[model samples]
Target: MEKVFNTRSMIFTLYGDYISHYGNVIWIGSLIRLLKEFGHNEQSVRAAISRMNKQGWVQSEKKGNKSYYSLTDRGRARMDEASKRIYKLESKAWDGIWRMLIYTIPEEKRHLRDELRQELIWSGFGLLSTSCWITPNPMEQQIHDLINKYDVASYVTFFQAKYEGMSDHHSLVNKCWDLDEINARYTQFIEEYSQEYKLDKQKIANGDMSDGSCFVKRSLLVHQYRKFLFIDPSLPKELLPGKWIGDAAADLFTDYYHILEKPATRFFESVFEN
Candidate 1:
């Protein structure tokens, strides 16, 4: 299955994983080369950069002839919030309390409703019904901000309550999440990297891991793993099934990621003068 890839998303990944740590700045030429592996042409990458700049995600600066791109304050804040979800592994024990957020944005405000739905999902909520969303963790602040932003506080309700359904927790999990699909994706991730991890280890030990190769592989790994965010609710462990494959995938990713970091840094440094 060819998972969807967007030039825009890839650029974000590049900045978040690499440039964010270095100085939040990237050379245009280096960026084009980085995006080339994903089949994005320089024109398209340039367009993506321009779009990001217009959207307040990035700003461009010229130094002599070469140009550089860096995240704007707005973009950094956005990435910071997103990174919380991407790297967060829920740790607090589930209190068995489900926080429910219900909204009624009316027909004319359907756009607001749609936007709110996406925000809720991003905040780890699962839909119980069209009007109601639930999460095991309390997201009062997120919900409050969303409501205030949309000016729909009067049309929304937030409640902390226990489940009163007849179904078991397993049934609820199945209903809230597509565990089978998530497991399949995790299994795929595991299969792709577990064997590669061994070879990568050997390469590192033998000093055969090239800087460019490390950069490419690490980028692919990070980009691929990020797809999980679109599907994963990041549910707490207590709410997950026994032997969740995501746990294994996370472990493998962390292991391989650290191994590639040094070489990838070397590659990036060589490409970006500053």
Candidate 2:
């Protein structure tokens, strides 16, 4: 809601933050009205919808004179995978062992190998070397499913072992994660939303804040935290250093989200009310 001007991104956000709950379908007119509130032009919205259709992310149907759109199977699957990472409220208890994936795809299949790298990263593996990836959490199922998806299971080996490093735990973590930058984002999110949360919260109580404003602010809140799925390995707390900002950030996010959810849902439901 408060970021770049990519029409595709706005459409995806609309689905992830709202449309997904609204039966994953929307009338074209309703989508246009919503996008216009976010400063998207009608043409841009249509073009973005077309591009998404080409990519098998969304499909459109016409009923009488009005159009409707919904996620395709591919699109729904993508959203489900992302939601697993983004909306997981807590990590399972750690077993004090790290899961490591070591792979060697053949040179001829280099493109698949490159694609595998992105999958590993998004699945929370930190690259320790060109051919080695590691995660503090158990990733047996994740690694198996991934390599199987790429049909490269034969090229990959898995291990579960405790870390025995030359340096301190902090150094070991720093070697694999950019915790500073990640924590900075948490701080930035807090700065951006902390003040508005209180004032807007009262406005909602007093029947002053409009439904439109609630919708925008709630989506922005989700977008701010959603970036972590790309960067956060979601390592266990035992693996994290003292005074971790991620903990604080999680607390702040939960509080602010609860404060906003009711009013936001009220607005969202109003959009579809007959």
Candidate 3:
């Protein structure tokens, strides 16, 4: 939910351009140009490049003050992981309707207005225009209930109809499900980190917490472990048997909140970015 120029996003932005152009070499100038297209300035782009190089995600060769970079195996892995997250964030199922609503609350109830708006966002509703929100679900009654509960019924109007069939909902679903490769990559990441950080599963299971040395390593491992339950938050608890799952799910949710719902919800938000 907090905006940051994460390594994942930077990998995707660069790899996306490479794939688009059918080329393997990405020059410094080209990286700058692509970042500019994504609304980033030169300094930010340079910082991302430096970070990537430092992390061994990419390798650069210099020729007369010009640099050309290519993805290392590690970079490819990161890009692969990012692609899967993007797919999960994008795919959805559609039951036809695109629900809409227009509400006008009393001026004095601005706090209520803000709360309702946040609720809608959490519920996968996107604003199509001021005072109007859209969702792929046909459950207008749920929206009505929210409005009434918030006491905005006095100034609200609701509408619902089938979205014109212009979107590829099935393609979106396929993308999300194409995460097996990403899952494999993450498993590899966990195994490597576990060895590097000397994470002892037996000790952790036996209640020994002293092995927690690398917080960054621990955090990255936990994040990847959580992707298994991204689409279904209520997955059987037996899938993850450790205190880390219990203690860290809440925090990791912040990083992965977008994919913590049904595929339909993901599809609607991706197709209709508010």
Expressed as tens digits, the lDDT of each residue in 1-274 for candidate 1 is 1224788998988888878988888889989887776678889899989999997889999998999999998688667766776676655787888898888779998988988888787777888887888888767776787788689988999999888779876677787778889899999999988999999989988999788889878888888888787788877778888878988888898899889999988888777656
lDDT digits (tens) for residues 28-68 of candidate 3: 77666544433567777778778778867678888778887
Top candidate when judged by TM-score against the true structure: 1
Report the Cα lDDT for residue 155, model 1: 94
Order the numbered candidates by TM-score, best leading. Answer: 1, 2, 3
Ranking by lDDT: 1, 2, 3
| Candidate achieving the largest lDDT | 1
For all predicted structures, in order, the TM-scores are 0.86, 0.85, 0.33
Task: List lDDT for all candidates, in order.
Answer: 0.83, 0.79, 0.50
lDDT of 2 at 165: 72
TM-score computed on alpha carbons, candidate 1: 0.86
**Cα TM-score of candidate 3:** 0.33
Number of backbone collisions per candidate: 0, 0, 0
Model 3 whole-model lDDT (C-alpha atoms): 0.50
